[model samples]
Target: MKIKKAFRRVGMFSLFVAAFLVTITSISNVSFADVRDWVDYEPMRITNTVTNTVTESKFRQSSLEKKELNYLEQKKMYISSDEIEGPKTLEEAANINQYPKSQVVATGYTAGVESTGKSPGHPEYGITYSGVQVKRDLYSTIAADLDVYPIGTILFIPDYGYGVVADKGSAITGNKIDLFFNTVEDVYAQWGKKELDVHLIELGDGTLTEKELKQLNETDSLQVFRQQITES
Candidate 1:
């Protein structure tokens, strides 16, 4: 009877140990499966060249004052009017060759230079110029639009239809982007800015010779960088 009791206890203990070990193995397997997708995501480098220009034109002023009464207001009210019927400046409309101090419009934002077609001769035509004058400082903006890149990435923008994030903006906090148009006509030309996916080529790789960057700049195109290739 004593031998039988001892045998029964030993059998029970062995069963318990096997069950505990199986439970631990199961837990370990689950943890590994959950983290399987998080391994080996390499960062990519990207670059794009932009050709930009700004044009400044003067606009006419209205004969109105702040805090002036409107037509039907019972009491005095603040009035602000748009300065229409003239250009923004008396200087040359398109000054591409000359370099003058540019006015800062909005900082930490993206800006562009384009034609309004509202010039007295052509009231409905315009195009983006490589270089123009502006009354305000242009800003370049980049945020969390692309899936690969992060916020606050500084991208160099040159002109129309091309831009990279030189700096990110709060408004552009997602996969969204804001492109600057020089005039209202150009803004409406495409019925507002369109969202599109972009491929960013990386830059700053040591493998790229200095000659490559110079060649790219001479062509007026930006250089991109790729990962290092091990020479076996």
Candidate 2:
């Protein structure tokens, strides 16, 4: 009986070792590319190219992040109305050559009725004025003045990576541009308005209508699709 027990123990130990080896082997077999899609979420820090003169990347203001917002109401209550300015800038609207690069006022937004007046599941929920679907992370989109940037103008914003002007907004004319976010909360938190550096890579062809040229040229799809989202 003792001999039998000892043999059973040896067999079980062997099985455990075999299983451990298999797991390590499987893990080693996983190619880096297989997991890079997820690992890339962290903002990249690199120098040389003209994304940000500061040489930093902002993690795409995630649209997938979900956090409790009950605390936000209390935060909002304390905000002095004196600090709140209307969405559009006080500067007079003028066309400027945004080609190659320029500074633009950047604001973040989400794809909700509050921003686009179209709820999720609406026919045009995540669609841009250019009619392309807007995506987050690396595929993030932007809204700018089409007259300046046009329908397919591509831009590289500091911290933010390359984003195509896929939509436009009324208040987005001139040097002002609106960025897409997952939630209105992110708009206020991650990217409240600011004048940021922009590197214009290429200008899109003027659509059926027109294109005079300059800053905040790309149109945002949400703004293009929803004419009724902004508040007075």
Candidate 3:
């Protein structure tokens, strides 16, 4: 009878140990499943965040480009009509002839390389006779006969654009003008003795009276000229 009782207790203990091991395994499986779910979800959340950031950046860049384009369009609209067309009326012609002595139909020449040692305002080659510095721009400076277009006179050429009479040359007498060039090659290549329609924009001292200034400001043809003079 005692042997049978001992066998029964051993069986009960083995069954209890088996149930405890099964419970431990179930808890471990639940924890591992939660960890797997979190691992899978984390990558998708990170991808969504990155996509949102890139989308916002692209939107801001597009907005900036549109703003810049609008600004450029507005600037184009402000360009004056006179720039597209020449002087129109007889009154316009008369106003332009204010400096009649300075205006002329002349031939153009190039200097710089033709000059000798220690010129007046230009010490490098000493090309200019008037002692005024010749500007480096292709159409901004010219040499003329002082008797015809005096120093400080501003001239407007139909094809060549605007220039200031800042220098003189012996060959540039009468109705002849010389356009300065940086190089002898450039001088020979671009200009020779070509007839030019020169308008005297201003004469010596170049001062504007209140009435003249007001008239220029009111006129559309002189808008660009007015702006240029005022800025200068």
The sequence of per-residue lDDT tens digits that candidate 3 reaches over residues 25-93 is 565443434445545443222235655642222443343334321122355466587767765532254
Task: Please give the CA lDDT of all the candidate structures.
Answer: 0.33, 0.63, 0.54
Q: What is the TM-score of each candidate against the true structure?
A: 0.24, 0.45, 0.40
> Which candidate do you rate higher for lDDT, 1 or 2?
2
lDDT of 2 by residue, 1-232 (tens): 9999999999999999989866754655533343453466666666766654545455442422321223223544665776663333211111123445788888887789987889988998987787766655432578999888887776766545456677888788998888887778767866688897787877778431222222232435223322222221
lDDT of candidate model 2 versus the reference: 0.63
Q: Give the winner by TM-score.
A: 2
Q: Is candidate 1 or candidate 3 better by lDDT?
A: 3
lDDT of 1: 0.33
Winner by TM-score between candidate 2 and candidate 1: 2
Give the Cα-based TM-score of candidate 3 against the true structure: 0.40
Stretches > 4 Å off in candidate 1: 1-161, 203-232
TM-score attained by model 1: 0.24
Give residue 202's lDDT in candidate 3 (0 to 100).
73
Report the lDDT tens digits of candidate 1 across residue range 1-232.
Answer: 9999999999999999989866755654433323342343222333333535343322211111122322444886655554343323212221322422222122122133232323534422221122212111122223333342343232232232123232233444444544543445544653255433333323222122224323433342121111110110
